[model samples]
Target chain A: MIKVQQKDFNYSLEVAALSEGNHDVGGVCAFSGLVRDLVGDKHIDYMTLEHYPGMTEKCLAEIEAEAHHRWPLEKTLIIHRYGRLEPGDQIVLVAVSSVHREAAFDACRFLIDFLKTNAPFWKLECTGGDSKWVTAKDTDTQACDRWLNGDKKE
Target chain B: MKILYFSWVRDRIDLGNEEIVLPENVTTVEQLVNWLQSKGDGYASAFADLSMIRVAVNQEHVKLGHPIGENDEVAFFPPVTGG
Candidate 1:
């Protein structure tokens, strides 16, 4: 499943719901991304995230499909939020369940890595007296590319 | 045609979205950017760094060489910053 919305999500409850009553699933790996208070030396007061309405969901769905194709995952859930968010708030949640622990871990990592580099979302940071647009980091692209090149060798 | 701007493009351009009609010669994303840059000072500044700006044609992320047609929704923005 894939979802992009503006409301905050309950991560723990979401994990339980995704893993509940699945006997075939022997392992579940999950990740949650939170809003950091600082970016470099700048102190972020808040952040406003924006996304292309219909396109964002489409891109996320494609990512999920790719993960399933690569790993034998029994279930997956991706939840991303937009609009204004503050420090310590949950920004995204990714979970993968599989019969094996390695598959679950790898798929979970792959989902988050791809979402960071390829998702069509923009973030605007507000500092004390000014606000600025955050630039894309090169590290994110490298992280996502690792999966395409089969760096993990799984 | 709908033209959507995001992130710093919106800040520099001072608008998020607009309706526009491209000239017949503006057939590619590069050409569209060149034409838009000439519209006014704001557009010129917003599109000043063409290399840093990314384009999406019809909701799919595309490059400068991407072909654009009439009534197609095009989006311009800075590189994505999502995780």
Candidate 2:
């Protein structure tokens, strides 16, 4: 499942829905991203996340499909929220379920890493009287590239 | 063609989206960016650095050399920052 919405999501509810009645699923790995209260000692009042309406969902679905193609995932869920949000608010969720823990763990990592670079969401940090758009970090791009560079475990 | 801008690109260009009819010679994304830079000061400033820009053709990511059609939706934005 893929959701791109302005409303925050319940992580437990999403995980329950993903693994409900799936007896074969032995393990699940989930990762949630949250808005931080500070950036370099500056207090963040709030942050705004913006995304392309149609393209955001499409890109997320494609990323989910790629994850499934890579690992034997029994279930997957990706929820990303946009619009204005306060500090500590949930920004995104990626979860994966499989018959074994290894697949679930690796695929969950892969999903989040790919989403960092491929998704269309942009974040703006609002600090006090000033605001700045969050710059894309080279570390993120490098993390995403690791999957394509034969960094996977055999 | 429908041209879209997001993030800093939209802020610099001062518009979210616009519809335009592409010229005969503007058949690729790279050429379109070149032509758009001549439209206004905002366009020139927004596209001054191609390295910071990323493109999507019809909602899918593509390279600068990607071909474009009149009906296609092309978007320009900075590198994605979401997780």
Candidate 3:
């Protein structure tokens, strides 16, 4: 499942419901991303996110399909929020369930890494009465590229 | 053709989207950037550095040599910062 919304989400409830009633799924791996309080010493008051309407959803769906193709995942969930979000708010969540722990863990990390570099969302940082657009980091591109070269087991 | 700008490009260009006619001989994204620079000061400033910008043809991320056609949705923006 994939969802992009502006409302707050309950991580515990969402993960529980995703893994419920799946006997074959012996392991579940999940990751939740939260807004950090500091960025290069800037105190962030809030972040305003914008994304393309139809394109953003389509891009995420493709990423999810890629993960399932590479791993034997029983279930997967991705939730990303937009609009004005303050520090300590949840930004994104990824959960993967599989019969084995390795596939579950790998798929969960793959989803988040790809989302960082490939997603269409844009963030504006509001700090100390000033607002500016954040630039893409080279580290994010490197992280996504690591998956293209080989799997974690390699 | 529809042209969409995102992130810092949208902020600098002062608009998110617009419609324009593709100039002749502007087959690739690089050529299109040069054509756009001549439209106005804002367009020139937004596309100042060709290397720093990224392009997409019909919502798919593309390279500078990607082909663009009539009725296609073209987007230009800075590198993504989402995670």
Backbone atom clashes (below 3 Å) for every candidate = 0, 0, 0
Candidate 2 lDDT by residue in tens digits, B1-83:
99999999999999999999999999999999999999999999999999999999999999999999999999999998886
Could you tell which candidate, 2 or 3, scores higher by lDDT? Answer: 2
lDDT tens digits, residues A1-154, model 1? 9878889998888888777998888989999999999888878999999888887888899999999999888999999999999999999999998999999999999999999887889888998878787888888889888888988748
lDDT of 1 at A85: 98
Once fitted onto the true fold, the runs of candidate 2 whose alpha carbons sit more than 4 angstroms away are: none
Predicted candidate 3 versus true structure: per-residue lDDT over A102-125, tens digit per residue: 999999999999998888888999
Q: Please, what is the whole-model Cα lDDT of each candidate in the order they appear?
A: 0.89, 0.93, 0.88
Angstrom error at residue B65, model 2: 0.8
DockQ for all models: 0.79, 0.91, 0.80
What lDDT, from 0 to 1, does candidate 2 have?
Answer: 0.93
Could you give candidate 2's per-residue lDDT for residues A71-150 as a string of tens digits? 88999999999999998899999999999999999999999999999999999988878889999999999988899896
Q: Number of the top candidate by lDDT?
A: 2
DockQ of 3: 0.80
The ten-residue window of minimal lDDT in model 1 chain A covers: A145-154
TM-score of chain B taken alone, every candidate: 0.94, 0.98, 0.91
Q: Judged by lDDT relative to the true structure, which candidate is superior, 1 or 3?
A: 1
Report the first chain's TM-score for all candidates.
0.96, 0.97, 0.96
TM-score winner: 2
